[model samples]
Target: MKWNPQDIETFLQSKEYVDTAVLPLLPVAFDSEMGQAAGMSEFITLVTGQLERQFKGRLLLLPGFSYLKTCEEEKLFTDLLLWESQLKESGFSHIFYLTSDLFWKSAESRLDGSLIWIPSIPLETMQEAQKISVVESQVKQMLTLFTGKWHEKE
Candidate 1:
């Protein structure tokens, strides 16, 4: 599917963060099968371009990161730490990442359960609105919580 975030005008127009919200778009074919990296690149480029068009000046479009096919647990552990540090050092002090193992006909979890504890948060996007809407809602909620907690403790 075409994953467009800024095209979610209905959702964005409802919030005041439309101008400063940076949306990272990861377009995966949720309906079809996964592991199709060839098609994933095209959507990544398209969504990056869309972010540039929509929120270039006021927002920041971060690169999407992915990894798979780890035969050992040590490599996965190292990669997770490195990625988290990289993102954190790059000023992503807080992140709401989605770690899911879709498909498998509900037989079992994907990725062989090795990277189940890869330090990623589970999120249910693509359900109510589009996945982008999920991101938008997350940002809004985070900002709200941040401000509320800041004032409450202050």
Candidate 2:
């Protein structure tokens, strides 16, 4: 479920079933004059929206974390760890980050959560059929990873 008032109400009542939090880590490069950058950001949001819908009852989709693409990512580590702590305190045992950015995967060990890096798919330029095909394919892979983690905790 996405972070909103109605979802939070439901979440509070059934917190046990909603043990996982999915955070979309997006990097916005304001300095980039590349035309595709904006499209990439939109694609990330749509793909993550699909994933959230697929895993609705079990996952809480938090508002995405956006940072300057050119900044030092190491500087965000402490902040991310603190966010993890707060999520744990709120009863989410599993915190997973989904991103098209590859940087987080390399720093996963240092961060306090599991990071899944999805290589970028240019959805903005694709035909509807093509976009659906890509989103569906990626969602399957994401589902597999999510399920694997869920079962592991059993």
Best by lDDT: 2
lDDT for each residue of candidate 2 in 81-122, tens digit (9 for 90 to 100)? 888899999988889988877777778898667898878887
User: lDDT of all predictions, in order shown?
Assistant: 0.38, 0.81
State the RMSD for candidate 1: 11.4
TM-score of each model, paired residue for residue: 0.33, 0.90
Error of 1 at 134 (Å): 17
Best by TM-score: 2
Our tally of clashes for model 2 stands at 0
lDDT of 2 at 68: 68
List the pairs of residues colliding in candidate 2.
none
Backbone clash pairs for candidate 1 read none
Clashes of 1: 0
Off by over 4 Å in 2: 33-37
